[model samples]
Target: MKMKTAVLMAAVLAGGAACFAAGAAELAKVENWPRWRGPQDNGSTEAGRYPVKWSGTENVLWKAELPGKGCSTPIVWEQRIYVTAPVAGQDALLAFDWAGKALWQTTVGAEKPGKHRNGSGCNPSPTTDGVSLFATFKSGNLAAFDFTGKVLWRTNLVEKYGRDTLYWDYGISPVLTEKFVVVTMMHQGESWLAAWDKRTGALGWKVARNYKTPVENDHSYATPIVVRQAGAEVLLVWGAEHVTAHAAATGEVLWSVGDFNPGGQKNWVAVSSPVLAADVLVVPYGRGARLHGVKLGGSGDVTATHRLWKREDTGTFVPTPAAYKGKVYLVRDRGEVECLDPVSGKTEWTGQLPKSGANYYSSPAIADGKVYAAREDGVVFVARVEGKFEVLSENNMGERVIAAPVPVGNRLLLRGERTLFCIAAQ
Candidate 1:
């Protein structure tokens, strides 16, 4: 599928400006998931009251069969669901209806495939701006497709931008802004964060991360989150060796901090992206387990003066910490769920999950006074978010879930190992 070059400039509105559906109402009210984590990149949802408990046979509104396997989270806009998959030698972009029916599946492109584990296809999640859906693959192929599976425009990041050398594969999901779609191409030789025209897939500009050590595929897979810092919007990126900021519009490096780990380590991987709450930035790095919070201030190069409160040995390399209220909630790889004060980096409360294993890849989704977590053992646990963790409900889908669940309206859209289910209150 090839997209036409018709780049347009229109401000994408939040979900609140729409009509009311019985379960999910406005766009912000619960429709557009947009990116990996929900709106605002915070995991917390403006979605209506979703159910606290659901099983395979209970409260399952519908179950749809996917075309192929993928770890990419499902993105929704209006009444359509978009997902990406690679079939045979071609990458397929499939669109499904609200009732769990396949609408159209189109072949986007085919290229040299990257290595992924446990049937995990490309980790790129599709991003929509309420009008168009933007997607990227492990092969460094990025494209913009319409609501239906029609391609709009495409670009080969490896050919145009340079080669992608990320260790595992390209897992960073793209984010859409008012004028451009931002992508993180953290690779060797050409390690940078760039912005492209949202209407047409044209390069606007790129800010390079001039690293002392040669660029490694081990740079970062962490997605960029747009934050309002010091009265202006800044894109925050955290990965292998550094945490930095860039102008969202022009791809200019606003500030940076490097040498996060003194002795360069290969096992060290930054899978979790940066989480922002107000002026404070909660950046987590692991395999060694360290989570830090830096307050944003100053102009170009704020690494020396802006380094603030850091919490060590408190996070997993996979689960990105979600910040709400004044605390940050996290789920370790072994299923240790805890809440910590973002400022002090101190644990407020910790709980040993019922289903514990080393295969936990899903992140904690907070909504309506509860934290929803899904594990590899086919379990979904709900705990009360009251500083002290309280297990309220334990639900299961009887399938492995690697991708995080997307909260839309009052329903929870979960993509398991073999099925895509919509669970909501009956």
Candidate 2:
């Protein structure tokens, strides 16, 4: 059966490679963010010189009010920015131009809001390949749109597959590779990872992920990221007390590390995605600050030998850590940021956020020699990435901020509770 599955996946990948080659080529030449974690899937951008300070009315280039609430970060491609929201009982996608003017808004599906406190219908961010935009919602509706807001293809995963049994809302953004749009749905019931053809909404491959973890630990709100290992791109999926690396061309498991929940804690639900720095994959186990670094390359069950380092003091619950310049920065839930050396897992420096008692759900964005960390109370603390953790600026939006800040060109795009602000140099 395993041999048959491998042979089928290889045939599917070979058939779709030619169809998506042009789109993949266009994606490589585009400088804008095409996915959830910027160009490289690590929350870092090459565009430098963002504004050092900004507020509700100060240093703000343009501010436009969104129709409803969402936690998904805005993605930029070429001259437009795309974001998803739940507006008037419908899951909608809103587009804005580089000037901050609202261009178009298209309703994708009926809103199926989650029952959790921080849950929303439109939690997953969209992905693009310089041609069309792909978005998924908590409604299980995944759709594709052109640059002018015209719907190309649409499908509902819950209706075709099974209903998502997630505790909170579905927040995993769609991952776009060379030939496939991969989506992972892992929850209490039947969990699976599936891939679809990027142009046509046809299913390419689906694989069931079986695990023996506790019920609560069976959920994952994290997104999948691609990493290059041994001359091949591998998709990294984290959930159910394990970090598994799958072949990007096909949904075959390459390697997995299952020691993330050694104590068998049931409530250690994974919220943060794994951040890859070169060949080392950093996996963060929720609630305990338990982090493990696994060296890439190897076959199945490499947990014992490939595990390089483990640390318990630097674990984070909500926000995903950012890696830049050979250092990893972790933002704790209660407004503390710590920088760790990727090699030895040693703390370089620890700094406190501007506002105390404020929770940070947004991941940190590292670029232009600074780290931008947003607090739940709408204050974005910008600190220098160099010598002694010096705070460069603290800009408050005066509204709740849940989405991570995105840096494009020379501006910082900040999505608050009800407004999107473009901060540039005055």
Quick one: best TM-score, which candidate? 2
Candidates' TM-scores? 0.87, 0.90
Candidate 2 lDDT by residue in tens digits, 104-140: 9888779887554354677788889887899998888
TM-score of 2: 0.90
Put down candidate 1 lDDT per residue, 1-426, tens digits, no spaces: 121111000000000111123434333454677777877787777447778887756777788776565667787787788887766667777787666777887776774454544325457778888878888877777888887678899887777766665455567888876788888765555567788898887889777764644334245668877876566667877754677777777877777776566656444556677777655777777452777778775676676677676656677667666766666778766778888777666778888777554356676778776788777666888888864678888887776676677777777788775577887777
Clashes of 1: 11
Candidate maximizing lDDT = 2
Q: Per-residue lDDT for 21 in model 2?
A: 20
Error of 1 at 344 (Å): 2.7
Model 1 TM-score (2 dp) = 0.87
lDDT of 2 at 394: 82
